[model samples]
Target: MRPSSILSGLSCAAFAILPCAAITVDLTSEDSIKSAASTIANGMMKFYSGNVTGGIPGLLPGPYYWWEAGAMFGSLIDYWYYTGDTSYNDVTTQALLFQVGDKDNYMPSNQSKSLGNDDQAFWGMAAMSAAELKFPNPPSDQPQWLALAQAVFNSQALRWDPSTCGGGLRWQIFTFNNGYDYKNTISNGAFFNIAARLAAYTGNQTYAEWAEKTFEWTRAVGLMSDDYYFYDGSDDTINCTELNHIQWSYNAGVFLLGAATMWNVTQSDLWRERTLGIWNATHVFFTSQGGQAAGQIMFEVACEPNNNCNVDQLSFKAYLSRWMAASTKVAPWLYDDIKPYLAASAQAAALSCSGGDDGTTCGTRWWNNGVWDGATGVGQQMSALEVIQSNLIDRVQGPVSNSTGGTSQGNPNAGSGGDSNPIAMPAAIETSDRAGAGIVTALILVALVGGAWWMIA
Candidate 1:
C-alpha cells in the first residue's frame, strides 16, 4: 500500500532476521555502539579518494570544498578519540598535515580562489582538536598542531575587519571574493570557537579576551539573537544592517562549544549563562515525530525538510552533534541534559544507513524510519559517523590541556604575516572605491601640471 507500510513489512522480515536491521546498535551496550560506529565510519570513507595515486592527500573530490575535507578529518579524529580505533588515524593525520599550507596556516594558496575565513578555521579547529586529544604528532620536521591552530587564529585576528560592521571577520578572506562584503556567523563563530578552545587548552587570557570580543561583536551586530539563536550572516556593505536570518545547526553548535569552553576556562557566570542559553536554543533542530521515531532526532533546520540541503548543509548536523557531545566534557553538568538528544539522533542516523549497494551508506534524513532516502556521500557518512560515535562521549576523558598532558608546541607569532600576500585579482579594480581613486588621480595630475606651468611663468 503506502511506501512506509510496504518498507515496514519487507525491510525487517525479508531484509533481515531482526527488526529494521540496517545498523544494529544497542543504546545500552558499549560494544554495540562501537561496532555500529565502525560500520558507519567505513561507509563514510568510501567516498574519500585522497590517499590514492594522483590524488592530493588533503583534498576531497569535486563538488566538495576543501573546508569540508578538513571537517571530515575532524570527525575521523573524534572517531579515533571515542572508539580507540586506529583504522583511520594515519589518513586523518596525513590529511591534516598535508593541508597546513606554505605558511603552516590552513590557507593553502590553491584554495585561495574560494577560501573563506570559516573555511580556514575548520582546519584550524581540527588541528586544535589534535593538540587537545593528543592525536599522534607529525614528525619533528613538520608543523606542530597547536602552532597551526595559533597561526590560523593570528592570521584571522589580523583580518578582523574593524573597517566595517564595527568589528567582525568577513566571510571571504580576499576582497575580490564574492562574500567579502558579508560578515557571517560561521566565520566569526569559528574564530570565537577556536579562541575559546585555545584559551582553555593553553591557559591563555588573550584568547579568552578575543572570545569575549567576538561574542559581543556578534551580538552587537545582531548575528546572535538575545535568546541565543544564531543566524547565517549579514551584508557588511550595508554595515551589517540586514541579516540573512537563515538558521543552521552548525552555527549554533560552533557558538555553543565556544561558550562552554569559555565557562570551563573562566568559570564565570556570564559564560555559564551564555552556554546554557545556546544549548536551550538548539532545541529547534530536534523534532519529535510520533511512532517508531518518537524521540527528538536532529535535522538541518534550514534545508532538511525541503530536501534541498547542499553538500555543505548535509554535513552541518555532524558538527552540531560533534560539538554538543564535546560540550558535555567541557561542562560536565551538560552531560545529563544533552545525553538523550545524542542517543536519539544516533539511533535514527543509524537507521538511515541502509542505502547504497553495500546497504551501509547513510542518508541525510535521519527520521526515515530505516528506509534510506537514496542519498549517499561523504557528508552523509560523516554526519552518521559523528552522531553515532558521540554516544561514547562518557566513555573517554575530556579534552586535555597543555598543563594536563597536551604536548603540541605553540607559536604566538606563527601567522604574523600570513596575510602579506593574497592572490592578485585580475580586473579587481571595478569597484566604486577604485572609480573614486581614478577621479582623484586625474585631479592630482591637473594640479601638478598647473603648479609646473605657474613656476615656469
Candidate 2:
C-alpha cells in the first residue's frame, strides 16, 4: 500500500462519533472536515495571554504558548492550501487577523513572555502566507496582511545585533528568559524565509539583501553547516563555542523555502545553489538507520526512539513539508526527487495513527516498526497530515502550471509562494526545495479532516 493512499481509504471508522453524520475525510469532505487534533490542541493547550507575557501557561504549562498556537495555525493554513477545503479558511483569516491586533503588531497582542525572535517569526511567516495567497481580509485601520509580516520583520531588524557571530537575531525579544543570550537557527531561518517571501511578493530588493545577509551569517556562525545541516544555536554565555548541536526540522525547512523563494524572485545562481544545497542536505534531520534509508525517512533525529519531541519541536517537520511542497513551484524539475520521499514518509506516518482511547492518534516516529509508536498529540497528527497532504495534494487540485510558479498542471498552489509565479529553475541543478500537537492526558482523535495557491498556506 502506498503511504499516500493509506488515509484516503480512511473513513468515519477512524474517528470518534461526530455530531453529524460520519463524513469521509479523504481529499474531500467540505465543511465537515475537521482536524480535531488541532482543535483540541488549540482549545486545551493554547489560550490568549492578554498581550502581556506572564500569566499562567494558559491551559498548557509552558513559557511560550501563543507562538505554538501560531505555528499550528500556520500548519492549519497549509492543510487548507493543500486540501483547498475552505472549511478552515474563515477560521484562519479570522483568528490570524485578530492575532495581528491593533496596528498589526503580533508581539503587543500575542504578549508571549517567552516570545523569542523565532516565535514572532512564526506569525510573520503566516502573515506573509496570507498576503501572498491573497487571503481575503476586511479593510482594517491598521496593516492587515503583508504589512503585518513586515512589522514583525522590521521589529526583528531593529533588534539585530552584530555583536554575536557578526550578525544574528536574539533568541528572546525580552531579557526575561535567559535565552536572550543565545542566537538560534529557527529564529534566523524563519527570518530568512520571511525575507525571501517578501522579496518575491513585493519585488523588493532590500528584502532579498536581508535574506542573503541572514544566510551568510548562519553560514559564518557554523549554525548552517557546510553540508546544509542546521545546528541549533550558539550560546553567547559560553563565548559562542557552545553551538547547541540539536538539529531541528524547522531550521532546515525554512531555509529550503527561503532559498526557493529567492531563486524564484532573483533568478540568481547563488539562491539556486542554496535551494539545492538545503534540499539535498536536509536528510540529516532524520534517521535512515534500522533498515530505513537517508532521504527516505522523516524522524526528528534529536528526539526520536527514546526522547519524544517537546511541543515546539513536535510540529517542526510540517514546515519542511509545507515549504518543500511549495518549492516545487519555484523549480518544477524537482518533482521526481521530492514527491516520492514525502509519499513514503506520509505512509510511515499514517501507520503511526493508532486507534485508542485518544481516538486516531499519530506520533513522530515515522521510521519505527509497522505498529504505531504510542506517541500522540496535535503535533503528531499535524505532522502526519502534512506529509500525507504533500503527496496527495495534486490529486485533488490537479497539477499547478509553471506559469503560476508551479508545475502541478491542474493542481492549485499549496502555498508554493503566492501568484507572483516563480520562475522555473534552469535544468542544471533541477532542484530543489524543501507537525503535531499534544499534551500529556492521553490524546484527542477524530476521523474527519481538513487549502490555495501562490502563496501556499
The candidate scoring highest on TM-score is 1
**Tens-digit lDDT track for model 2 on 1-457?**
0001011223224444511121123324333233432333333223334323553321223433567667666766666665455655665665576666454547754475566788778887877766665455445643556667777776676666765445678788788766889888888888888878777766657778788778877776667767787777776654355465557677888888888887887787877888889989777655665365555878776555444345666667777887777777666656677877776676566555653344445655777643455454546666776676676444433222124343111111212234332222212211111000011122112111110001000
| Cα lDDT of model 1 by residue, 212-323, tens digit | 8888788777778778988777776766666666688999999999999999998989889999999999988988752344547998866666566667777899999999
Model 2 lDDT at residue 377: 54
Q: State each model's CA lDDT, in order.
A: 0.81, 0.59
If scored against the real structure, what TM-score would every candidate get?
0.87, 0.73
Per-prediction tally of clashes:
0, 35
TM-score, prediction 2: 0.73
User: Compared to the true structure, candidate 1 yields what TM-score?
Assistant: 0.87
**Model 2 spans > 4 angstroms off:** 1-64, 101-103, 109-112, 139-142, 237-239, 288-295, 392-457
Error of 1 at 155 (Å): 0.4
Q: Which structure among the candidates has the greatest lDDT?
A: 1
